[model samples]
Target: MNKAKILVVEDDRAIRNLITTTLETQDYQYHTAAKGSEALLEAVSFQPDVMLLDLGLPDMDGVSIIEKVRSWSALPIIVVSARSEDRDKIDALDAGADDYLTKPFSVDELLARLRVALRRARQDAGPAGSPEAVFTNGELTIDYAAGCTYLAGSEIHLTPIEYKLLCLLAKNVGKVLTHNYILRQVWGSALPGDTPSLRVFMATLRKKIEPVPAQPKYIQTHVGVGYRMLRIPEGGPAAPLGE
Candidate 1:
């Protein structure tokens, strides 16, 4: 049974009930709050492993809550909102949300995203030490110490930029990296044409690592938002891209 603790912050009683019911069926521990103030208090008091937040909170905007929580915690926050616009997604993502789910979503999809966030949270909670020396995802292995990446046991040469991009995505496997976040981390700042440049580099990087770039097993794009590195199971079908 799943043991992840979740904090549900939504003003709509029906929607809140739907989410809590889903969590209950999975045997996930959860606490609910109807207002942003109560949500923050529960966030601190409950210390949940993840948060399912609605952007349109009656007390305050969910983005503000995200910012407040980010100040003291690295807790995973997934925005579940009726706002489906690209701008809304970018705003929440940029404000530090780990993932965004538009309303009218499937239970399966919601559970999938929660699993991804839990994986990332567990990774972040690893023993305190010098950071992880290497990253492995399926056939891909990144040796940070040696500054080299290998695919299927063969060293794959990558441009400096491509290598950095790969490292960033690998380090953040399962968490959606917004375009602005990617640009800032890889390019050090957002400049004109940086987004296009990032896409080109990502495509080249995929060609080297993915067995079938057309149907990628590792990188999942979020259209206008950004990309996420999928942790695929051996011999299992890859999750759908463009989520």
Candidate 2:
């Protein structure tokens, strides 16, 4: 089996060395870059299976790198940064990061997240010779086989987590998926305290898929329970949960 390739983009030499050492110990084929511009070039040349990115690059912001890469590829990106602020994490995630880890993160946890990301990527790729599965409702469409989402004839960009959340709801349209259920299915685990993270991802997903996020016509909140993706009737108006 071919070892997975990883690209580590961190300006700090110490941190970069530590990450590369860990990757080497794990038997991963890896490359490193110390600047955003170099990272972009390496990403194209290396074509890594996954990436470890730092937000504080000298040439450009890591979020910008994420946005630029996401413009064409679905490569998994795990952000490793010292910025522990929620806004920073949200920004990176919204910009296309698959996961975020603050400075002084445990190597074990990082490896676990990397495994999860790789597994999700493989699942999303589906199996060879299998028929494509495409789900649609009015103007919203999800092409599971192609790993793409479209809203009103235009392709929509969704973060890894957002796309997973949307797929879960879209697959089970009209079913009220509890927070715990959605969290476990999309995130691989569910803790009572992780509800807020699930809510945040759901909000982001709605904003990308809903015509009016404030008055969401497709995804509806059940209030205190969970959310439901409304099943649009053919040539008819969307109905509420109980209707």
Candidate 3:
């Protein structure tokens, strides 16, 4: 099997060298970038399976890099930053980092996280043909093959994250998915304080898909548990809202 390629983005020379050495020792191929601009270029050229990013890049904030990359790709990003504050970690996760590691992390922990990220990435990969080629419930429709959503026969624009969240819930229709599970599946890793972020995304998604956001017919919340997608029956109306 081919070794997994990793792109390490850190401005500090010592830390960068250490990570590269560890990568080499682990028999992984890697490329290095000292700044965010270089990191983006390397990310494209190298097409790494995963990325180790530093939030304190000299050229740009690592959060910005995560956002930019997430806009176009689902590349797994494991943020390794010196910022240990919960707020900082949540910020990175919210910005789309798959995992977070504070500086002074153990090599073992880092490798374990990388393995988890890779495994999740592989599990989340879509099938050869579109697995969810098309999903429809009344006016709302999702065409996975075309990467588009439509409501009332008109195409609706959704941000990348919103689209992803919608697709996840849609794919598992009629089953209640806990908030933590949704966060981990959608945002990569679920942090303790990430519930509010999930709520915000869910609310935005509801507004787009539900005819009545307050009394949503499709997406239903399980009050203190999680959310569920009501599997609309063919040629029939959605079920009652309360779950």
**On a 0 to 100 scale, what is the lDDT of residue 183 in model 1?**
98
* lDDT (C-alpha, whole model) for all candidates: 0.89, 0.80, 0.82
lDDT of 1 by residue, 82-196 (tens): 9999889998999999998888999899988898889788887788934589888888899999999999799999999989988898888888888999999988897877888
**What is candidate 2's lDDT per residue for 15-132, written digit by digit as tens?**
9899999888889899999999999999999999999999998889999999999999999898899997766766786676766678888888777667756655665577783434
lDDT of 2 at 144: 93
Give per-model TM-scores.
0.95, 0.57, 0.56
Ranking of models by lDDT: 1, 3, 2
lDDT (Cα, tens digit) per residue for candidate 3, span 6-69: 9999999999998998888889999999999999999899999999999998789999999999
Better of 1 and 3 by TM-score: 1
Candidate 2 has a TM-score of 0.57
Better of 1 and 2 by lDDT: 1
Worst 10 residues of 2 by lDDT: 234-243
Badly placed stretches (over 4 Å) of model 1 are: none
